[model samples]
Target: MTGKNMKNDIVNKKDLKQLVIRFYGKLREDKILGHFFNHVTPVNWNEHIKMMYGFWENVLFFTGDYSGDPMRKHVAIHKKHPFSLSDFTHWNKLFIETVDEMYKGENAEIIKQRAQSISTIMQIKLFK
Candidate 1:
């Protein structure tokens, strides 16, 4: 099925991989947030995508295949460029939109909720 049609179709490793890759594709092009990935460090797309796959898999499925200090990384990035509340809002919007467009189910809801929670914590930590 087409990627959009895949929404709510199924949740699994392969589908989660697609969701992450597709989401990042849109995220990297976003006007408000694009610079972070595109200009901040000149992202290694393959590596980033791989790491994201592991992250989402672990988050959604408890795969235990991902490990990293996301908060510390964001803190460093915030020190460098400073993400604002608006940036986090835009990120949440994109994250929800991406997840809703690609999947809809328990795991899909969990992803969106987790994104919201992550954004909330990041905002508090970065701006507090």
Candidate 2:
């Protein structure tokens, strides 16, 4: 469906969950990024998905629903298998595409911007 046909901003937790699930679905299937989640670190998807829902919810709405040091987790993963710039770039690309495909308006735009900013920060921290 086109953006015109699907005109709904990510307004609440339900929307956030849908976006997270869909975005991670793509991430799991992604060639470059998938290995990190599926092999490198081997995420427990059930818990991870719930964590991400809270993460994005807090990110967009400041709901204080999530609490975890994402950087620390990534740092540990980096020690196990170093992440390159392309990993972050592809992550941002997939995130933006997923958001664009599923949402629009203020929240959608903010989430994309935040995802990009977060990706950039992660690259700097991990690659530095």
Candidate 3:
């Protein structure tokens, strides 16, 4: 792959969106996260996907598409329910699985590592 082509691949956005959709598509059926969605607006599944895409894009690429602090959001979510490390570990695993099932590349590995790091950090903070 040439430099320009590699740049184009990284510029792609669908991977992020797909991961969000598939992850939540599962989350909507998950025993843990599913129940919490009861408070969600439920009218903006597409919007939520975009938000998640922007979030991962920014976090993994420094693109700045995401403006909110994910840790803070997780903390707020934790306030409503005690989030365990196992939950985040499972979430990261699902996220990585979705990405792997969708795309195969070095970028996928980067996203996986970042997701795991984020989940680990959040898990530690939530526990503390």
Residue 92 in candidate 3 has what lDDT?
77
lDDT per model vs. reference: 0.84, 0.88, 0.71
lDDT value for model 1: 0.84
Instruction: List where candidate 1 sits over 4 angstroms from the true fold.
Output: 1-6
Report residue 40 deviation for candidate 3 (angstroms).
Answer: 7.8
**Whose lDDT is higher: candidate 1's or candidate 3's?**
1
Over 1-128, each residue of candidate 1 has an lDDT whose tens digit, in order, gives: 77555557436798888888888999888888999999876689889999999988877788847899999989888888998889888889888888887777888888788779877988898898
**Reference-based lDDT, residue 90, model 1:** 87
Residues 39-117, model 2: lDDT tens digits? 9999998888988888988889998468899999999999999988877877888888888888889999999998888
For candidate 2, report its TM-score. Answer: 0.93
Better of 1 and 3 by TM-score: 1
- When 2 and 3 are scored with lDDT, the better candidate is 2
Give the better candidate number (1 or 2) by lDDT. 2
Residue pairs with clashing backbones, model 2: none
lDDT order, best first, reads: 2, 1, 3
